[model samples]
Target: MLKLNYLFHNENLAEMIVKNWSYDPESTEMFRYYRISSNAIYPFRKDGRTQLLRFAPVQEKNKSNIEAELAFIKYLRENEYGVLVAVKSNRGEELAEIRTPWGVYYASAFVRVPGSAINQTDLADEIIFSHGHALGELHRLSSKYEPEPGAPRRWSYIDVLDWIDDQIKEYANAAIARSEVQLLREHFADLPVHTRNYGLIHYDFEYDNVFYDHEAKRCYAIDFDDAMYHWYAMDIEQALDSLQDCISEELYNHKKHCFLEGYRTAFDLPEDPDAVFPALRRFANLYSYARLLRSVAEKWDHEPEWMQHLRTKFEQSMRSKSTLFGTKLS
Candidate 1:
């Protein structure tokens, strides 16, 4: 259920179901235009309070994996990790069942969260450095719990690298980036030796996945739906990559250094600071393949802009990795 959401939206139109969730006839309030993605996120009021509700469908195979995540978030929340206060529906169901155009989907909600998602400009020394500290705290606290085999944590670079190669080869029959895929494949074919293992990470850690208050110097990370096992070094790259994408060259380097300093203050590092680039470059390869498949799927859903932009971005990501190999990555 916590998997990438685009599929749910395409498989079943969730917006219509969300509209049905509202039993009120007033229809007086201006409903913000929200798309029905894999999840239905709606701005609603309960007892005069406004909040956001997010819901998704689950299958039998993934039920425990999803519930374990909710349980962990519950544990972390109790431990004062400062995560979302999950809003459960009637009868205290954190993961509830709801019938919809898509048959049935799981549902959960939360009070309207604060702060805008982070961007490059937000990587000023204060903002990003604080974010790094907060993330380090997250890794520190979350490391307290462990899963037997087969529990879902954030997805890692290694978990998806093989999957990426599979997908790129699948699209090898298309007009997509062949050379990029080749370079990616060449590196992936020999990745196991260079990869480092680390502690639990928010494998999906990215700037956009977190919220920040530049004024208060506070940051919050959301969407642990992809939380999984991986090296904390990967988490470092997750933070740095977002800054590099959002900010200018000069600020990017500065923010990255300070962010690393903050991270080290809270946790230990497994690899050299330079390791972040190669780690993320390898990560970017996997990201490209995922987006390419998603773009293809969305194109079938008539999202031309998303498809084309992802295609262009995929090539650009590959091009960006043209140098700095053998030394850092190999």
Candidate 2:
């Protein structure tokens, strides 16, 4: 579990940040702070435009990680990808360091992407297809990406699993969690990796992370904080999981088919993309379990009602070993 007490949760600190960045404190029209996992995101209005301020503890996100993330964003922008661009500070740095009573935090700003989140609307085939196409473009570009010599490398799948293993070891279902992780490791070990098949990817390419401009029929991606080195198929699986609660299976399948078709236009996937779902689903479950444990360990003493509800949901999912696509893990 990562510590989050150092977050810029108050207006005073938020105002200080605004001034520190040479932005007009009086021009701040709206400001809010929220947390997702260990990261603190501050979305605010200034200069008649919306912008996002994100910060994380140094231990959770070091300088190298920040540079890597910003570099990837810049690369994507240079390649004409629709992404939220990072804004340089007054000091001409993409990332800035802020010290508070709790700890040190690394902060960065991004220009707000135009349009609204796709999650606010019904799932349309065109939107789904566009999502797939955009991700495919990212994969194609990532296939050729080369980080600077000392840039932080994206975390491998095994790295995430090992982190989760550490989290679940103290839980009541430790053995079950460990076994599931081991099975996933075995399955992943058998998969082939090549430039065309593996590279950095937007691992969380779900609706909320993407914005849709209905008029322009374009999709813009934001929040590359979770981007990592993984198989291209994993991004597809995660996108499908985001649509798990569609009205019916028929509509879901139709949307998925459209998405895959769009993806194939840019890069070839496995003959049966569905074959990778089981392993990815198991990984998602383990990841969720690990997050639940970490959240509890960090915030259980001050847990809110929503957090408790989420804990209940995670516990049930873990006990059943349920996959996102309506299958039970053996």
Error of 2 at 158 (Å): 1.9
Q: What's the CA RMSD of model 2 in angstroms? A: 3.3
Q: Encode model 2's per-residue lDDT on 142-226: one tens digit a residue.
A: 9999988877776778888888788778776467667777778877899888998789888889898988888888789998877
Question: Candidate 1, residues 1-330: lDDT per residue as tens digits?
Answer: 122334333413434433434323232142453434334565556556665566666552245555777777776677776566677665567766677656576766666546777763435677777778877777777556665477555444455555455545655433333444445456545533322334456665688777786666677677776565565666777677777778778677777878877776666655565644564566554465455454443234554565456557655655555333223345
Candidate 1, residue 69: Cα displacement in angstroms equals 2.7
TM-score of every model versus the real structure: 0.71, 0.87
Tell me the spans in candidate 1 whose CA falls farther than 4 Å from its real position.
1-40, 57-61, 120-123, 148-197, 214-216, 294-329
lDDT of 1 at 128: 74
TM-score of 1: 0.71
Clash pairs detected, candidate 2: none
Candidate 2 least-lDDT 10 residues? 321-330
